[model samples]
Every structure is written in C-alpha cells, then in structure tokens.
Target: ARPCKIVEMSTSKTGKHGHAKVHMVGIDLFTGKKYEDICPSTHNMDVPNVKRVDYQLCNISEDGFLSLLLENGDMREDIKVPEDPSLANEIRSRFDNGDDMLLTVLAAMGDEAVIALKFNTK
Candidate 1:
C-alpha cells in the first residue's frame, strides 16, 4: 500500500441502524495524486510505514539516478530526482553550481523518492 497524507477527514453521525461513517481525502505522498474513501468509523485502516532520511547530494547520473552520501560514509544510488521539472532543474542547477545540498528521501512499501532539497548546513 502506498503512503498518503490525509488532506481532510470528517466523521458523520451514525443513523439508527448504521455505524458512523468516516470520509477521508488523501494525497499520495510520492505521486501527488488524490484519493477519497468512506468507511465505517469502527473499521481498521492499514497505514504504511514510511521513513524519511536526509542525505548529502554527491552526484547525479546522466540518466537521473542520484548519488547520495549516507550518514555513515556510504553512497546510495537507487532514488532519482523527482518528476517535477522545476524541482529537478533546481536540484541540478544547485549541484552544478557547487552548492552543498541535502536531499530528503521518503521511503515506503519498497518505493523511494527524493521529496525535498535544501542546502547542507554543515
């Protein structure tokens, strides 16, 4: 299951013979897509385990793979720049200008992506 950020959630009062209903609107964390669901208030929903890590941007390959420096002095290359052209261009431009960059990567359900970037403070 993909991880989503709940944009809106509300509960409707129960009727005489029915359980309360919950209406939820969520945006996919990785894809920027919207999803809506209505369920009984008593129902259990599956929540994906999501992790975020900040990595030092070291290099970007020609085909878009990112070379990130791990905290423990290791390099990881599985994630790529985000699909948004503006973000990708900003990342590349900053790196090309020799600015130290820190990239925030979000991982969930075996999927990972670079979600944000900022200058490295150190």
Candidate 2:
C-alpha cells in the first residue's frame, strides 16, 4: 500500500560547505514515524526515497491482481498471457473504476517523479 501523506518535513543544516547544506526529516501521516536523510544539494529535494515505497506498492498491486485471478480460477497454465486478457481487463476496469483517493494524495506528494525515478533505477 502507498504510505500515508507526509505530515511534516523539517530541515537542519548539516555542515558549512562552500554553500550551506541541509538534511530533511519527515514523518508519515499514520505511523508518525520519523525518518531522516539528506536532500539533493542542487534542488533541495528529498532524495527520491519515496519512489522506493511506491515501487513496492506497485508490486503489491500486481500481487493483488494475481491473487484475485487465482481466487477466481482465472489464471492460465501458461505464464505468457496476452496483455489485455479477461483477468487483466477486469483488474484494469476495477482499478480505473475505483476512486482511490489515496492515489491522488500520493500524486500530490510528488509520487509521479518518484515513480519515474524508480523506473530509471531499474
């Protein structure tokens, strides 16, 4: 699942280089667990760790699709199935029909860039 929204972000100067550098500390929406890491120097952006979580969530979504197919007795013996088979179509339909507000929330949290970074990392 996608993580809850970032409730807060705090920064602290790490050191005095030729220019000042800072690190970011953030808390998740539900757990409120705090995590600290360095920001990208050039952009002051969080160093794309959010993408890792998003990729994991995408894997979980795929697994959920597989589980659904298995439960519905729709999985084929062949691993190489067509991209838009019935199961795939059903999954896509459900995913598209469902108004998953969390997705929008994640997108607001810069998930698009994170997802792009995840693909590049792979």
Candidate 3:
C-alpha cells in the first residue's frame, strides 16, 4: 500500500438516487506527488500505517548516504539525504559545524526517508 498524507477533504450531499460522495486530495509521502480520489462515503478505504523515527545524525557520506545512530547502538546507513536543495544544504552545513542533530525519518510500505531534522536536546 502507498502511504499518503491527506491535505484536503470534502463531502458532497447525498443525491436523490445515490449516496454521498467523498473527495480527498493527498500527497504521496515519499515522492511529494499529488493524488486525488472520489468515492461513495460508505466505501471502505485502506489506510497505510506510517512510522516516524528519530535517530542521531552520525555521519553523512560524500555520496549523500546518511549514517544514523539507532537506539540499540547500531548504525543505519541505507537511507539517503533528501533531494531538496534547501534542506540538504542546511543539513550539510549544520553537520559540518559539529552540531548534535537528530534526523526525523518517516517510513511506510518498506520505504523510508529523512523528512526533518532537529537539534539534539541532550
């Protein structure tokens, strides 16, 4: 299942011969693409389970792979830094300054990405 974040939702009043309709606009969580769907209000829809994890920013490779410090003292290096230019620049500059940072990673449908960053509170 694809994970999406709903950004807009609207409902239409029931017609004389049909049930109410629901319109939804969502953004693809991983790709930043727009998706829209319309269906009867009573239809059953599957919702994807998304997970957010915060890991210590250990290192960033020249090729953009992120080394994340996991809670179990292990390192995760498979996730890459995002392609957004502004965010990527911010991350690289802050890390180069020796700041302790925490990366917020969002995961769904066996795919994961670095979505945000925060200063380490400790």
Candidate 4:
C-alpha cells in the first residue's frame, strides 16, 4: 500500500457479472499529492508503518535543514525542513528567539519528515 491518508471512499453494488468494487481517494502524506484506486471489497491492503516522535530543534544547518535532538539524546540531521512556506517561517522565527521547540517527526518505511513544530515552556 502507498503511504497516503484516505480522503474519501465509496462502494458500488455488484452487477450481474461484476464483483463489488471499493474506490478510495487519498493524499500522499509526505508529498501532498492525490491518489485514487479501485479494488475488490475483499482485497487485502497494506498499511505503512508510520511513527511519530517528539524531538527538540537543536541546530539549523546553513542549507536550512534541521538538527533535532530526540528523546534518547540522539541527533537527527536527515530530515529536511517542511516545504510549506508558512510553517517554515514559523519555525525560523521560533528558532531564532531561543525558544524551546517541540518538533514532531513522522517516519514510515525508512522515509521521514518534519511534520509539526511548536514552542514549549521549560
């Protein structure tokens, strides 16, 4: 199965010589692209192993990527900054003010990205 979030789904009745079909419309969680497919109602589907972890933004690279310190104290520099313009500005501003930032990292099937950022007290 693709790493997408279901946006809509529908089922159609089976015709005289047809099997029932389930149609799903989804959006790729990482890329924000649309995906649609139809399959038999009995078809087994795969689900990606998505994990969310909270980390602290420890450093910002010259290229704008982030260095996040995980709960275990390990630093991750692999995930790039979010592509959303507004969120990126928010992160940049928050990081500049020496704020305690809580960064939520999302990972699935070895693919990871920064999904959320927020200021924290303490």
Cα lDDT tens digits for candidate 4, 37-58: 9998889888888999888888
State the displacement of the C-alpha of residue 37, model 2, in Å, after optimal TM-score superposition.
1.6
Deviation from truth (RMSD, Å), model 4: 1.4
Tens-place lDDT digits, model 3, residues 1-122 = 46899999999999999999999999999888999999999999988888999999999998999999999999999999987787788999999999999999998988898889999999
Error of 4 at 16 (Å): 1.8
Name the weakest run of 10 consecutive residues (lDDT summed) in model 4.
113-122
Worst 10 residues of 3 by lDDT: 81-90
* lDDT score, candidate 2, position 51: 35
Residue 115 of model 2: what lDDT? 18
Give the top-scoring candidate (TM-score): 1
Ranking by lDDT: 3, 1, 4, 2
Q: Which stretches of candidate 2 lie over 4 Å from their true place?
A: 1-17, 44-122
Tell me each candidate's TM-score. Answer: 0.94, 0.25, 0.91, 0.91
Q: Candidate 2: how many backbone clashes?
A: 0
